[model samples]
Target: MTYLNGVQVSSAAVSTDPLSWLDERASERTDAGLRRHLRVREPESPAIDLASNDYLGLVRHPEVIEGAIAAVRRWGAGATGSRLVTGTTADHALLETELAEFVGAQSGLVFASGYAANLGAVTALAGRGALVVSDAGSHASLVDACRLSRARVEIAAHRDVAAVERLLAERTEERALVLTDSVFSADGDLAPLTELHRACRAHGAVLVVDEAHGLGVRGDGGRGLVHEQGLAGEPDIVITATLSKAFAAQGGVVLADARIRAHLIDAARTFIFDTGLAPAAVGAARAALGLLRRDPTMATRVLDRAADIARIAGVAEPDSAVVSVVLGEAQLAFDAAQTCRARGLDVGCFRPPSVPTGTSRLRLTARANLTTAELDVIAEVLSEVLADARGTERISA
Candidate 1:
């Protein structure tokens, strides 16, 4: 047996070399101008700052900063342990209670990230033989959750209620879940939650909504999309949100029926094994929520700013705080982003994998704190950049 093992090991040993396929892929990305690079900038830099997801512009708000500082001073910087162990701080509990009340849910659970919360919700709520009917354009986190759940996943066309109904009808199983995003991250389109809820009821399936982009930007006082659609208190509904965006905090949450929330407290691996959110983030989120409740005008201002940006671009009409300016090719999109950056305007450059349907675009997000003068400058620069790119078919920068 040892001699045979030795011969097999010798045969399996191969020289260390780069895979040809990987090299080809790298070359393909370079040639198509779709290669991604990161830029480091100081927080105080004088950039136009259209790239970040600070919808309400609360990241720099004094209240939010003070809340974070107070929490850290009181509870320390780290969570120190998992929730099931020693990580469940007083701040976490307070944040959960407030978040659930704000979103009209019976209860809520906090997680380290929006992605982790999505995974915990999707994977724990469904299992093998369970049916998961998902939107084709749902976020990658939810997609990966479905894959990890090992359930029979049937992807319906994006926002197609009839297709979801058809899939639910054809299935022989009784256990099923329908998942979608409240507002799509790429194009800022909203899902038809009313139609989806009605279909799910008819099919006896649970509905899960990811409100990552909708929270702090939709509904009454930015309670989120589910609240805006009047589905917040549904008995069979579940919603997930990221605090990092509009909340200007640093955590994620899973909101659901009381029973499901209890189940997650016991069974969700992401919650059980991962350390709880830091006290600073929890406190910051609480403070942000309070600020939103007090100042509803913040939501309106940012949404209006996003609309103005779309009108100036004349390419993509934004439905929410995100506006995507379409560029025909990947290289042009990257170059346009660089040009915008050179002009001290930072924006997101999205290509094949990040965008839906292989569309390349410049993604701009609006903030409530940006002055009208700043926006006008951004508009002028962007219009000039687009005109130059359209005329020359490339950004000279």
Candidate 2:
């Protein structure tokens, strides 16, 4: 065995034994009830979907399905290369234009996934010489982006505008970025975008808002919270969103000024190196966007369902379509999720490190298409789960 950074390493059996620490971690996770296994979902499964991000329930819309099929027939199965090469199709350009126009942005750039979009935006915009002030409740993607940014990063208390303002005002770097989520995933709460933008303007800092959970569930006609706040056209504010969440597709986009878009095309490493967003996803997203534009009422229906869910779950109605039920302890949340599944409901189970310790939760997302019968079933199952969990529940919902 050889020593490397105080760790033992050997050439023979290195492929297997070198990763033995992973086994120990797995054992620890199992002991703590943190071990997770993927559940196979058949296309025709009968389970009620309260866990997916399909806020409008458009994933199975005929038009969206046809859009994907048409795209595949026309563009083949994939993009074939990065956008800088042969991957930028006319479909890509059109979708980008429509998305930018929908959110009132000067331009838009698509990425393979929302995670990549966040990574590209943060890394390209903020680097070693800059500062990044992030909300404590930001998604993992944004947190990872801040790390990849190589900037001096600070975490303000969740929804603490004053702390964020102070961080921006006190930063020594010539450039700074204020990062936040329009709709926080875990708690399903809205951020103070207007106030954050004001502070950013006062301190000459850029504001980046991830609207992954906001785009199809907030604002009139589902234009997103940024648009609702009348900040869509602001040059200093950047918006990143996932097509998958609301659009029922499989990609991400950065909506910004034409200049910023140009810079990202040139400097965003993720965009430059990663294979372009698939054509089928572009087609599906475009179809979903068209549906949203034509039937703006879908957004309202989603929120209404969300409110119903909150009322049934005995929690406050959320700002978006997410209804979160905190069940505390990892095992408790796991059991509740399993119970829900057994009752024909599929709900999200968020535990530590996804959430803070002692704050494991069952995250339920509302869908525009969820029937009244489904809601009643949810009430039947969830009420029992929560009441039972109360015996051991530590954190409050």
Candidate 3:
């Protein structure tokens, strides 16, 4: 007999069940009430949607649909090969230009997804003999990028500018990259970009801000937090964002100086090896961006709606579209989310790995197009749900 992942199995049994170790992990997850499930949603859900990152609510907009259809008609269904080969389309170049201009960057490079963009930017820019300082609350993609960058990685305290500065000042490497999210994904908190950028400048480090939750939900005309803070065209700042969120499409992009963009094109493995973003996603994102450009008020509308949701839930308004009601314990948060769903409202339930062990939460994301009636319903449902789930300890900042 042998112990496989602490599960006792006979030699003969191991031959029959080579993957039996996974069962023990699955059982552990179930016992901890941390097992996740995939609920298949229809094209349109009947429930009021407070669960998605569609800040501009343009996913189903007619122009966006038309843009996608037009791209498919013009460029075919797939990118076919890596950009270095045959995947780069006219639409890709146009979208990259439009995005760079919109975000006030000297240049831009699109990627297969936000994750790939982070991987590409970090890996291509910072490698051996470099130091990387990451915010504690950065997205998982950035964390993975740091690990894969082959640099000495240090996790500064969450949004702690002083800590970031200390790490940069103490680093022995010739080059350093500071990575953070302009808007935190789970808690919807804003990073101290200006302070961090100042520190980076003082220490001669590059600052990389992932605007995954910032673009289309922050800044004047949805230009993102970096643009709002006047860091858009800074030579040492690199901005990464996802089109899948507010752009109502797919893909990711890195916005930076022309030189940085050139280096990524040549050295970023994710870009050199991955297929270019599909034409439909490029077109749809472009159309969505065009809509946001035409009506910058959509940014304000989404933030206002988020404030409304926060007020109704008896929680402080978040900096971004994400409004979290931290209900202690994983099962409790899960139950609260299910209760909201039963009341015809769909909200995000974050637990365990997404947040701290004791800080499970019901996450509600606001959209620009939420109607007054929808807000009222959210208020009613959350009121009832919280009334029952409020016995737990409140969330800490």
Per-model TM against the reference: 0.93, 0.94, 0.95
Where does model 2 exceed 4 Å of error? 1-16, 392-397
lDDT per residue, candidate 1, 1-397, as tens digits?
2234356445344435648668888888898776777667886988888899999999989999999999999999989989889858877888889999999999999999999999999989898878999998899999999999878999999999999999999988768999999999988899999999999998899999999999988888888889998898898899998999999998899998989988988888999999888889988988999999899888888888898888777755676899988786888888899999999899988888887534788999988788988878887788788888678443222
Tens digits of per-residue lDDT for model 2 on 296-344? 9999999999999999888998889999999789999999899889989
Pairs in clash, predicted candidate 2: none
> Where does candidate 1 stray beyond 4 Å?
1-15, 18-22, 356-358, 392-397
Best by TM-score: 3
Q: lDDT (0-100) at residue 289 of candidate 1? A: 90
How far residue 202's Cα lies from its native spot in candidate 3, in Å, is 0.8
Q: CA shift at 30, candidate 1, in angstroms? A: 1.3
Q: State the lDDT at 185 in candidate 3.
A: 94
lDDT of each: 0.88, 0.93, 0.94
Q: Comparing 1 and 2 by lDDT, which wins? A: 2
Q: What is the model-wide C-alpha lDDT for candidate 2?
A: 0.93
For model 3 the TM-score comes to 0.95
Q: After superposition, how far is residue 170 of candidate 1 from its true place, in Å?
A: 1.2
Prediction RMSDs, each to the true structure: 3.3, 3.5, 3.6
Residues 1-397, candidate 3: write the lDDT tens digits.
8887999888776666768889989999998889999988889789999998989999999999999999999999999989999848989999999999999999999999999999999999999999999998999999999989999999999988989988898989999999999999999999999999999999999999999999998999999999999888999999999999999999999999999999999999999999999989999999999999999999999999999999988899788999989988999999999999999999999998999999999999999999998888887788788878996444321
